[model samples]
Target chain A: MSHSFRVEATADRLPEANAGLDAWWSGAGLPDEARFAFELVLEEIFMNVVMHGSPPEGAPCMVDVILDRQGDGVVMEIADDGLPFDPLAMESPDTAAPMEDRRVGGLGVYLVREMMDTVHYRHSEGRNRLSVFKSIGST
Target chain B: MNVNIESTEGGVSVARAHGRLDFGASAEFQKALEGAVGAKPKALVIECSELEYVSSAGLRAFLVAARAAKAGGVGFAACALQPAVKEVFEVSGFSKIIDVQADLATALAALA
Candidate 1:
């Protein structure tokens, strides 16, 4: 089964994205862990775009999210029509740094890469699309 | 997410976060943490006993708050996280920078 949804590219609209995912996941009947993983990944990517995507001034931006069930797991694709930024190519934050020395900027993208089983990114048609896969029913 | 800031006997600000802390709640979560840090208490404790989940945005809030606390010469710690939430902190290496304790009592003790 596959489901797709869209949200405005604004940080305030994040709840709507989460609501859409919850409505779909609840009926899809996936395990709690799988659902949690998707939720975390979705928030990270969506928030990054909303916060830093730098859409055209005064223009509206939208983020598209698609979920497909793949065997015992699920594949998620998040695409945004905003400034092109490949989160995959970003540097990983020094997680071992001291609290005073640590910076929070790149941690979200790093978390997305670590949590998802597989992740890929591409820029096409002026949209930044990120693909992530995670297995359910098994850690 | 809901955050309730409490004052411990040791003059620590314990911010108890309930429900899920994600992008949807990041703004409020960050605000609450900022409030706790602004008070300039001797220490700030994030009580996550009831928090079921946290996202990268949420983690960022904690990091920012911890930084603020350090700047103000206030201690910072988080405790009683659910297993899944703990995994998020561990994987993100937040546990390495901040004090992640086993329970609220321990967190308060550390702050004291």
Candidate 2:
């Protein structure tokens, strides 16, 4: 089964988007760990679009999300009509760094990469498309 | 997220966080934690038994608070994380840089 939705790329809309995603995942009877991974990954990518991918002219930006359960794993695809940026290309944060030397904000993409089984990014037709997959029982 | 701050007799400030700490709630949570650190208690312990969820944005709040506590010469630790939150911490390697105790009692005792 697959669930699809669209959300405005604004901080204020995040809760609503999360609520909708949670409701769908719950109804689908996903395991607790799978649900948690999906929630975290979605939030990471969505917030990145809201924060760094928006246009400079204050144009309205929107993100499209699709979540699908395929056999023993789940796939999530997020497409945002924002700047052409590839999140997968970003450098991984140094997780072994000491607290005093660690950069505060770079851990989001790194966490997403670590938690998900696979992540792919593409920029096509003026949109940033990111797809992630995770097995249900891996967690 | 709802963060209730209180003080122990040992001058440790314990902030208990409940509910989801995602992108939407991160800013407010960060301010609350930073405020707790700004008070300059002997130590700061975050009680996370009731915290249901946390994303990377929420993790950033913890990072900022940890840095502030270190800079201000205050001890810091977090305890009783739910499984999902614990997973996030481990994957992000926050369990290394930040002090993580098994429970509230252990957290307080470690700081003592």
Candidate 3:
């Protein structure tokens, strides 16, 4: 089964996007860990599109999200009509740095990678597409 | 997210965070923590028993608060993290940088 929804590329719309996923997951009957991974990865990638991939020309950007059940796991596909950017290509932050030397940002993409089993990014037809999948039983 | 900050008689400020701590709530949560730190308490302990979720943005808020507490010479700790939030903390290496305890009593005792 698959569920689809769209949201404007803005920080304010993040809660709506999250709500859509929450509503879908309510009936999906996935384990608690898998649900947490899905929610975290969705927030990370969705915010990336809103914060970094928005167009510079002030055009309205839109993000389309699809949650699909594959086998015993789930796959999420997020496509945004914004600037071309690959979150996977971004450098991972130094998670080992001391608090005083640590930077505040840059952990979002890193967390997404750590939580999801597979992540793929592609830019085609003027859209940036990101797909993330995680097995329900793997935690 | 709802954050309630109160100071104990021992000069420890306990900030209870309830609900999801995501990007939408990060700025507000950061401000609240910074405010608690600004009061110059001997220590600050975040009670997270009711905090259902935390995203990277929420982690950023914790980072900022920890930095502020350090700069201000206030001790800091977080306790009773939900399982999922704890996983994110460990994955981000926040468990190494910040003091984490099993419960509110332990967090307060550690700061003492």
- Candidate 2 Cα misplacement greater than 4 A, ranges: none
Candidate 2 local accuracy as lDDT? 0.89
Candidate 3 wrong stretches, greater than 4 Å: none
Please write out the lDDT profile of model 1 over residues A14-62, one tens digit for every residue: 8899888888888787776668778888988998888768655776578
Model 1 local distance difference test score: 0.87
Best by DockQ: 3
TM-score of candidate 1 on Cα atoms, chains taken together? 0.90
Q: What is candidate 3's lDDT per residue for A1-139, written digit by digit as tens?
A: 6899999988898999988898888877666656888889889988999888877778668999999988668999999989899999988889899998887567898998999889999999999999998888642
**Candidate 2: docking tier:** high
Instruction: Compute DockQ for each candidate against the true complex.
Output: 0.78, 0.86, 0.88
True contacts kept of each: 0.92, 0.97, 0.94
**Alpha-carbon interface RMSD of model 2?**
1.1
Local accuracy of candidate 2 as per-residue lDDT tens digits, A18-137: 877888888887776668888888888888888888887887589999988876788999999898888887788888999988875667888888888899998888889999998886
| Interface quality of candidate 1 as DockQ | 0.78
Better of 1 and 3 by TM-score: 3
TM-score of 2: 0.95
lDDT of 1 at A41: 88
Candidate 1 error regions (>4 Å) = A52-54
Local error of candidate 1 at B80, Å?
0.7
In angstroms, the error of model 1 at A30 is 0.4
